[model samples]
Target chain A: MRPAAAPKAIVALSAAVAAPVHAHLVETGFGAFYDGIAHVAVTPADLIVVVALALLAGQRGTRAARYAVFALPVAWLAGGMIGARWPSAAALPLLTTLSFALAGALVALNAKVRDVGVAALAITAGVLHGLVNGATMAPAGAGALALGGAVSAIFFLTAILSAEVTALPVGWPRIVVRVAGSWIAATGLLMLGWLARSAP
Target chain B: MKTQMKRWKQYAALGAAMLVLAPATALAHREAGQAAGFLSGLAHPVSGLDHVVAMIAVGLWGAVLGPPAIWVLPVAFPVVMALGGLMGLLGFPLPGVEIGIAVSAIVLGAMVLAQLRPPLWVAAALVAFFAIFHGHAHGRELPEGTSALLYSLGFVIATGLLHLVGILLGEAHRWSAGRQTVRAAGGGVALAGLFFLWRAVA
Candidate 1:
């Protein structure tokens, strides 16, 4: 190629192959943090688990609710770090659905599980879904910063939902929580049917 | 002036009742993508006369039954309906889904009209039984290639809202005049259900 055309060719190639450069870059056109927040907002599967766990913990009482607030985001961050490094979440959706479904069922039943049980559930759901989120964001080079944003979002969502549910009066209000749980479980079951029907 | 205001109030109430009674294709829409699926799902449960009446009957009957039954029936309906939806999704083939749905309207509406207080367990069982038919029909009728999750969410939310409407209407049972009004509504629902049943059979 002629020397005059070589610069143009290089510039064109750079544009075509431009990576979401993170090294020495504080922010791209849209920041990674916002990207992470938006990701969780749109993902219903994760939201359901977060909601189910919050409702379950709150139903269990103040102690369980408090434990869940801490366990959920911490476990999610830890799991996310590992998943970002590994970056494979291809087969996670099925397990994710089942996790939320079971959590919802437990909430609906108003199970008399101990505080530890709620903590365990929170941790399990946090790690499982966080792994998927991490795997998704890592490929876009969001890494720890994006994961931190997501963890914050999860933290807030779990905190508010559990706290509100904890404060609710018993009887009719409590019954409303169970009704929400039933709806969540029903959605999961329907999704399961869809997944099973469409699986290749 | 007072008489004119009273007449206007009556006209407005009548207009509202007519709007509610009209099942202007509450369920049917074919649109692509997730948002569309949500809208479509939201409309699904209210689309048909048969579904709307039966769902309202569930709530109305619950109101008649009172207390735990009020919450229990509504809670159980979605779960059971989704089970039926699953069956439809998997091609499990429950026979007479349409007939069952029509019958649900007929029977549940009749129960509301009579204000019959059966045992709680029996009430729950009947509600659950009817829910299966509703769910199966919904599942089978789900639009192909739409976002299943959004659609399901919207559909469930709509169904719950309809039950809420019934429950609200049932709240009329608190007073003597209100009780008569509620009973009258139930009778109207039963008549609608009968029409639907005839249509289904024919």
Candidate 2:
């Protein structure tokens, strides 16, 4: 009896240990939307580009800035929809990084562009970013996740742009913005190097 | 003057809260039930000293580098880390994973201690490369039935929060004495890395 009881206890322990681990923050329902937002929010690469572009747009004046505010989300959603239809390309990361680097450099140099140019830049950024978002989205509820990503992007871009626009034109603030742009360029170059080194 | 002092006090309290909440062990455990997804993902990074140290070091290095680096390093880390996680999930093999992880602590800590501000891109590359090792560890150890998406979200958020803490601490650089304190923290991290390296090699 004692020997049989020992085996039963061991079996129970093994069974307990074998139970599947839980991993999702939200396992069902609207959790998917939260998951989508979480995905975008956690992605530093995307956020930086969005902020950098917004800053550049704001610097260009109200029209480019307003266009950015509208164009980015629309382009992002369209890009996501397109990405859902096509396989993710290896070049996408490179393109995104380059876009970021370019944006950063423009900001650093305080370069001015036509409003159309800024709009194009915003659109390109949106599409690239949206494509990445779409690629990661679960197929079953891709739309919900995309909506979340759009919402986050819009909110983030608006807040940053508004702050930049409202802040008084102080010497140090301008310097900080330029410094941020330089940093973006440097980071982008580094990523490109890493990509080059790791490429097969 | 009173308000300034109060602000300092608030920051101090927040720091205290951070220290109190900081996880103590470096062992990963699989959660058995409903607590698994986000909680488990969040636990993964803080559970391991190597992960925590390297991550905090990234933030510290970022702060030291200033401006864009403060943002770039943190951002690049997670995106590249996700790629690494995907590779792990696909069963791709990366050699010297443990060594790479231990070395991350040593290298990142040393960067902080020496105040090595490389070109921003170079720094970002360094942070991104090491992130893969950490992400792989998280991915490989993902529980049997958890949603990979949620788990990824949890860990990313957890990792970002840790970076934020390091960034806040790195803000000590604004003052003269605070710079030394931040560097001292870096030294402590480096020494801990050495210990981890020894344990790994042994």
Best by TM-score: 1
Clashing pairs in 2: A22-B36, A22-B37, A23-B37, A24-B37
Q: Measured against the native two-chain assembly using Cα atoms, what DockQ does each of the candidate structures obtain, in the order listed? A: 0.20, 0.04
iRMSD of prediction 2: 16.0
Q: Model 2, range A119-151, lDDT digits (tens) per residue?
A: 899899888877766654534345646456555
In model 1, how large is the Cα lDDT of residue B129?
95
lDDT of 2 by residue, B26-140 (tens): 3222122324655776788799988888889888888988987887777667656656765665567888777788888889888888888899889988888998888677644
Instruction: Write model 1 residue lDDT over B1-107, tens digit each, in one string.
Output: 99767765765665565545544433212123678777888988878878889999999989988988888889889889999999988888888888899889888
Please report, in order, the local distance difference test score of every candidate based on alpha carbons: 0.82, 0.69
On lDDT, the candidate that comes out on top is 1
What is residue B85's positional error in candidate 2, in angstroms? Answer: 1.0
For A79-193, candidate 1 gives per-residue lDDT tens digits of: 8887877866434777778888888888877889899999998998888888877776676567687788778888899999999999999888899899888888888888888
